[model samples]
Target: MSDLFSAAADELAAASAPLADRLRPRSLDEVVGQEHLLGPGRPMRVLVESDKLSSVVLWGPPGTGKTTLARLIAGASSAHLEARSAVTSTVKDVREVLAGAQARLGERGRRTILFLDEVHRFNKAQQDALLPAVETGLVILIGATTENPGFSVNSALLSRSVLFRLEPLSDEALVALARRGLVAEGLFSGGDGTTEEGPDAAAKAEFEEALEVLAVAATGDGRHLLTTLEVAISLARSRHGTGVSGEQIVLGIPDVEGAMGAKAVRYGVD
Candidate 1:
């Protein structure tokens, strides 16, 4: 009945959410990789820690942490964040956010951070509509895009914002992330890739080896790595029956390969 369906949906929601979001770093300290921008004494880190951020554009390939960085900045900033996706937002939406930003600044002496995901999706006119607010600092723009802003964003709008490039997660970083993920899921006991001593030793060893292989296969895409890991976990659960999960489950190279090959899962943390 409706009650049964609702219960099923509630159970599946967390399992189905994009891995990047479910395992999202809660604080700047929890974030891995991107040391160049977030390392000690880095200008961006300094600015964010002090909450003195200005209009900036985050440019990077998918799964490189553009959205994550924007959200963190918004949390740390002195401004109110008004997030939107250019893929779904029209000029009217942009105008509304700008108006809210203006009113907020005028009435309460506050600033606003407009974090636009896929800002490159905005057409010339739509991009232009954001210019006045950005230029005048009524809204601190934090535009996230996979495309090059120089080509996709309006020249006028692009010039007003500081551009920060995010690099893809390196293999080492991805491996570290994989280990962290296993720990988070309770598949591994600790960050050292050690099991909790109750799981089968052979199975644990095989799973660890498979994790390395999968990490390399992920090829610098953290979202892909994490999402595929979730799928592999599900496969292990099914293969061994749901009674055994997390630490006691049996997963190996075959599970990873099966998850990768079964279907194309486009869901991710971008």
Candidate 2:
């Protein structure tokens, strides 16, 4: 019976994994942070609602969900989504993407959203190659960069795309995301403390603490927080004979100490 239960638990966790990850939010409301972008009357909100997104730039530090937001924008639009990473893509890749966009336009009469991740990594020559496509509506460029685009991106290409700055996620928002992750995974099955008993007080508290510290360490980057939380949860479950007990969870002092030492100030807009 113990072996059977263990196997069942493992299967459940495995099955739950994809759904939990996928539930990461397709819509802006589903997104945990970045309220500034999703908030009413915001330019991003208007674009998403109107499906009128154009060539753009997403600027922020690593793990701040730039890639995710860019993808979401592409998904939200009727335009074709084409992605290229500056670190690996060459002028040839740019030309190919442009060609594909042109082909799609001719075949389906669809627009294109060209997402250039780590755009700041591209040299002047690469940026210059994209100017014609971006300017002529052959491609709607969505550039993402960990560095400052103004310093690295060509002035002409930079002038054409609207720049959107993304900030880091806050401890509270990170914690909220973590809790949602748990609930979404069906790991904490229960009703209000009165009903099914849900997650125990100790378990909930520990998860909150772990999430808070992890988020602080992530420095407002939602992707970083999610990845770290996933790893921590996996590790904790492994230690507890795959049961995922609160005691099994790891909490780093660097994160805890950091969270404790810092003054309370919200990071991400939402």
Candidate 3:
């Protein structure tokens, strides 16, 4: 009975998760955008494949996959992963992680990766707490920051780490992401209505046109693109009413415009 309850709770949690999270790519291959970082022979791809990453920083704009990439790359390595947010973490937190990492290294010959998100928020003293562990390889620091590290990071710490700049996603990448978002929302049909066997001709055309509008508004941010789609999907269900079994909910331009507060003028007559 407890096991069944546990499974039910897990299912409830997954059902309530945000669409963008639910849509997160499972493998590096499924990941969209960042081809420059993950392409064949790219530095990141090489490091992940070889499990040889050192202390490094990922610099990128919002929604460009900083946190996602950090988790993916670290998961590929053999080291134990510990994540903390600079926004809420303190010098004490940093010191504790470092000490634990030291103990782990001594006892098991294992490494720990401290993935510090929004690392620019860490003050000088908090960062200082990490320097020794980072320098000695007691912990591999994977710092992610939206701000320029040269200006925000300590000069000494910055020098010891590799920095990779992640660019805003391209238009093509955003489009692909929006399509995946559609499938995740179960909008086109029960199955992913992407190919010829998916949605009918007219429905697919409307879906493509609506996605194009979102791509323009997304401004190379995948998160923004997907959030809008999720809202639009909600608006569609609300507008159509519920309990309409087996009827595919179509997400069209008007639905997107409503979600985005876009005026009818934004998209001229068909």
Candidate 4:
């Protein structure tokens, strides 16, 4: 049946997606880092929850949840979200989004939130194209960049938007994120009825050590942490066999080191 084929396709796509993309926070509460901005009564949280968010620039290091926050803002708002990457988008893309925003507002009175990822990559002209719509309130622009917005963003656009700076995640935050990734990958029990009984105390300890190494090597980048975790999981599974058994796939320090290459040493000599 068509429905069965569609379901199969969806499963395949989900399986092929990166662990970071798959584990991305679906709601503001699920987001791991950026506490300063998402904390209670914070300006960003207040604006997002109240749905009164104006044009804003999220400046941060990679993996600090810029895109995640933007997505959450869009999710919290009644606006339709349109996401584009500056690396692949051009002035024409900006115009198209603006045009669509105009039509959506005119026809249904719905606001549009335009999320531009890696916005620093947008040249002057491309960035300029978004100004009219953003200034007129036709589109709520959420520009995310790993670069300093002050130096990269145009003055006009920067002046019109509130700038929220995101800091690198702390080690504790990165560890928590690693735990979440482990649960999402089914390597750790989720306390659900479907939990698999596996791994004795020794294996669990080894896994914990590996996780700590990964968290340290991640260097405050959540995406890098998850990616390394995924690679470590895969490497461990490959060496341990993929059969569903009572024993969990315990990853050792070597496995974590193998996943991260040179950066793994930052965790300290084994």
Write the residue-wise lDDT of candidate 1 on 1-270 in tens digits: 999999999879977776677888877777878898899988779889998887889998888888888999999877898899999999999999988988899899999999999999999989999998888888889999999999999999989988999888887788788777766666753355665555566665666677777777787789989998888877777787867767666557677878789433222214
> lDDT (CA) for every model shown?
0.81, 0.72, 0.83, 0.84
Question: Model 3, 1: alpha-carbon shift in Å?
Answer: 4.9
Give candidate 1 regions above 4 Å deviation.
1-16, 193-195, 198-205, 241-245, 262-270
Worst 10 residues of 4 by lDDT: 187-196
lDDT of 3 by residue, 160-201 (tens): 898999999887788888767767665663234543345577
Highest TM-score scorer = 3
C-alpha RMSD for every candidate: 5.9, 7.6, 2.6, 2.8
Task: Name model 4 segments beyond 4 Å from true.
Answer: 1-4, 189-205, 242-247, 262-270
Q: Give the TM-score (vs. native) of candidate 2.
A: 0.77
Q: Residue by residue across 91-131, what tens digits does model 2's lDDT show?
A: 99998998888999999999889888889889888999999
Off by over 4 Å in 2: 1-23, 189-195, 198-207, 238-270
Against the true structure, candidate 3 reaches a TM-score of 0.90
Give candidate 4's error at residue 155 in angstroms: 1.1
Query: What local lDDT score does residue 185 receive in model 2, on the 0 to 100 scale?
Result: 42
